[model samples]
Target: MITPGSNITDRFAIVREDMHRRYGQYFYADTIDALLDEKIAQAKATAKIETFLPVTVEREVSSELEQRAEAAGRSGTARPEILFVCERNAGRSQLASAITHQAVGDRVFVRSVGLNPSGGIDPQVLEVLQERGVPTGHMYQKEIVPRTVHRASVVVLMGVDEVPGIPGDRVVRWDIADPAGQPIEKVREIADDVEAHVKNLLDELGKTNFNAA
Candidate 1:
């Protein structure tokens, strides 16, 4: 039988090796290093490692009040409104929103919503974000609303199910693995994945110039 606290590194190594075997391109050392480097650069520039905010909720009128005022009566502005959504409003969604907000600065407005709202934001998520020096102000778990959906420029889905009634063009599915009730190490791994994806998305947005006004 396996010991409770025995070396699990070997097991992890085996799993990693198996993953490499399954996905050769992603498992290569060079590719992994490049991805890590990109994530590091993104984290350094933004000073956060958690997933950035979703693309949809970031465009809400409440979130972009100042931007809206700036373009009052005009056609529109050029910023993107991003919304991050998950099963619960606590962990992953919060991390993604916080990271995105930090990564894009004030240029993009970011918010997070939940299919089934939780009591409050997860403490562990807050702890991880604080460690990365990302401000936690204005972070809270709230229910998804029609207004939230209508306002988002892009809606990122962290959960499995597609958010009902959201427009097809506005939706972006991330399918991030949930980190609830897991060990800190597992949470960190998930965070790293989120960070990588956020960097990729940022790069895509830069190339596409998909921001709305």
Candidate 2:
């Protein structure tokens, strides 16, 4: 039980006790206090009811912390990386990587490579993503470094015919139509398909609790 001592507000007492009961073994009082402060700060502007603020903040912070703890536990194992490859870096591969990154955050190690090594991302693809409000974080230069393919748990081959298909259950293809240099309508179609596919893949792989990026 927590007493609302001189420094501890009744709200803090409730939140602290709840979190301590839930995760005190994994975190110390000072650390949990810091987390509580951060969570409250994050929710300060929200117009939600006051009666449940502590509960809501505690739930969100605890969930995020639990996920981080689980990821830390798997440090001994090689990170479960997902590699996305396509003919060029501009379109489908980037879209898939961006969607997956957004859904899983850093929970899965995501790397995208282009066999053809295009120097720039396609404008139409960027336009579509912007319309949908997806953040395409860090557009990396595309290159087929041998090490990435060898380390990936799942290697996805997107619409790129030049490279020979990698044979294995771990390697799959999206069969999405390449949108590079395509008309805006065509690019939009490819984007929609990629979004759906990425969502499904995240749901499927989330069972394994992908490494938090």
lDDT of 2 by residue, 1-213 (tens): 222232324565556645654555455658877888888877766745555566677688778778866877722343355778887777888888876766665456677777777668988888887777777556665665322333467888888654454422487777889887799988888877887777667667753433212
The candidate maximizing lDDT is 2
Task: Point to the candidate with the largest TM-score.
Answer: 1
TM-score of every model versus the real structure = 0.59, 0.56
The regions of model 1 sitting more than 4 angstroms off are: 1-76, 207-213
Model 2 stretches astray by more than 4 angstroms:
1-79, 146-150, 162-169, 207-213
Tens digits of per-residue lDDT, candidate 1, 1-213, equal 122233333322333322222223223445433443444345447634223311111222123433433465433445566778888888888888888877876556567778888768877777777877778887878775433343567878887475655543477888677888877777777777777777777776673332211
| CA displacement after TM-score superposition, residue 135 of candidate 1 (Å) | 1.1
The CA-based lDDT of model 1 is what?
Answer: 0.59
